[model samples]
Target: MPGALTGIRVIDLTQMLAGPYCTMMLADHGAEVIKIEPVEGDPTRRFGPFPEDDTERHFGGYFQGTNRNKLSLTVDLKKPEGRDILIRLARDADVLVENFRAGVMDRLGVGYETLASENPRLVYAAIRGFGDPRTGESPYVDRPAFDVVAQAMGGAMGITGPDAATPMKVGPGIGDIFPATLAAFGILAAHRYAMVTGQGQFLDVAMYDGIVSLCERAVYQYSYTGRPPVPEGNQHPILCPFGMFPALDGRVTIACPRDSFWTELVTVMGRPELASDPRFRTNADRLQNSAQTVEIVESWTRQLTKAQIGQALGVRVPYGEVNTAADIFADPHLKAREMLVEVEHPGSARPVTIASTPIRMTATPGGVVQRAPLAGEHNDRILAGCGFSASNIAQLRESGVIS
Candidate 1:
């Protein structure tokens, strides 16, 4: 069956994590994503974790993970001929995504105005550190930024660590990925609008804005209390017995924010009477004595292994083990859900496994259907489809317009 985005074509002009990640989501859902690379290729092609015996080194895991299911067409936009080629491609594209700084695309002569002129119904999406001036002006518009910068400036790292004084960046690149995910949603919304109105508009997502939205709880907490919220370590600030607790082998998470669930948990712990103890009777009482409540819960949990704890409380209340990659690889739930998939590595004899898309549809499912392409792998096919004849391609190649 055809996927939901089977007929859409995307021109991917992103190099790093954010833009490529957004385009990856589209490609996984069956969009014909054409990744436009410069002569040197995306810098991520050099990022490592290559197979032990593989030596050709065409690409690495970082590039493979996000660039899957897309075609590569190298074009050096510095050349007028190269820029014209992109203009031609964009004329027929449904969406064009890029993550360059504010004025980079305009300097290349293929900015939103240039492309929109060629394709009125194109959804042009830009993911940047701050945002584009076209929508709104920012003081830091010209400043370059990465994930950490966005996290720090956007308030995510402000209340993210063990304490108020020690802020920590998140393990994953949420600063980039969150904005990329929003950009993808925005692109779809704009595309839908174009389909209805026969017009398209430029949309931009700031990494800073994305993280701010993600940390929305802090916003309201500060507003409600007239005081900034501080980090409460692993536990929630307002809930008691709602965080990671020690186990015999590993840690487990248990949340009991309601009287009924607290009663059930205490019963399972062989301490049912404590549920009604004056200090632990209600959620408010427990919050007032959170430390004591946590100690009481840990005293029982520390005696059991993660599996033992699960056996006792898995379906009764909210619970989970702190899963690592090894645990995830061996998890029955992961297999049952088909969350991991194997794909061919270009330079290796053995195939490799990567996480599959979690988007599931009954009639038109989406997934990783193709491996990452080699640099300029689809140059001939793509240019031919763009009406470039054999001689035209050869002449362009001779002029160093493409690789």
Candidate 2:
């Protein structure tokens, strides 16, 4: 049988993080993804951390992380001819993914409504900052948003720091990655549905909405207890001893989400008394005295190395060392899982490892097959395959229709 999406074709007109990541997921699963870029190219091609390359456009680690296993094509979408090509591709493509601002795609006449009219079986998926206009326009739809904007506005920042007085934004691109993942899930679901019914639909995924979901625990706390949630800094607000604690050499995390695990942890720490003390007995009591409980736990943990802490706790209490990228690079578990992938960059002249696809499928496994394409690197070849003559491609390049 073919790989999961071998017959599917994706027209990717996305740049930067969110939409690129969504389409990249599709590509990893054997989708024929044609990543369309502006004639100048996707801005990320210039965004660092660029390799030591002489070429003008190449992989930034960020771009390489998200975009791979996809063909590259360049077009000037500002012109009618370029838009026409996109329309033609969309008519035959299984999906179209975009992440333009609220009205940009519609203004360009390539929005869902326009394409769906021509190809009723096309899955038009979009990622937006917030206020996905196609569904319900957010009040902030007109405002521009980046990763941090979505994290902060969507409540991720409100309860991620030490206290209400010092709300902190999440460290990663929570906004882009979460919504991109959600959008990919929606696209896959839509693809399944379209295969069954032969009728495609629009998918609207908002980064802010996704980040909001990520902070839903805070929502539950505030709505139920009427208390503003405070950041515990890598710890859960409700679960004591459920976060990072200092170790002799480095830090590690310990989680006691279950009563039995708590009992086991305190027992191992030679603090079995904590298991019966009225102020620290049950989970509820522990929550009430969370600071003291964590302090006590950390006091024990501080004497041991992170590895020792993890070994003592075992998966029985879900403990792990706080590893850096260097630590990750040296990790045996990650190596066993094949989670680190090596791809060669032109300038580096050596392979650099990036994270691998997280999902595992026995039937048709997915992986990073290549580094990101340079700006319009495959433009001529792809356009020629689209049935343009060699001279026509050259003419388009000469006319600035493509670089």
Cα-based RMSD of the predictions, in order?
Answer: 1.0, 1.8
lDDT of each: 0.93, 0.83
* TM per candidate: 0.98, 0.95
- Give the per-residue lDDT digits (tens) of candidate 2, residues 1-403: 3457788999998988888888888888788889998877788877677666535446677777887788888899888878877887787889999888888988988888999998999999988887566688678887877899998888888877876578887778878989999999999999889999999999888888898888888789889999877766767777776888899998988888888888899889988887888998777888898889889998899999887887887766778888888999999988998999998775676677788888878998877777778778888777766677898878888888888
**Clash numbers, per candidate:** 0, 1
**lDDT comparing candidate 2 with the true structure:** 0.83
Candidate 2 contains a number of clashing pairs equal to 1
Give me the displacement of residue 93 in model 2, in angstroms. Answer: 0.2
- Candidate 2, RMSD to the unseen true structure: 1.8
Task: Name every residue pair that clashes in candidate 1.
Answer: none
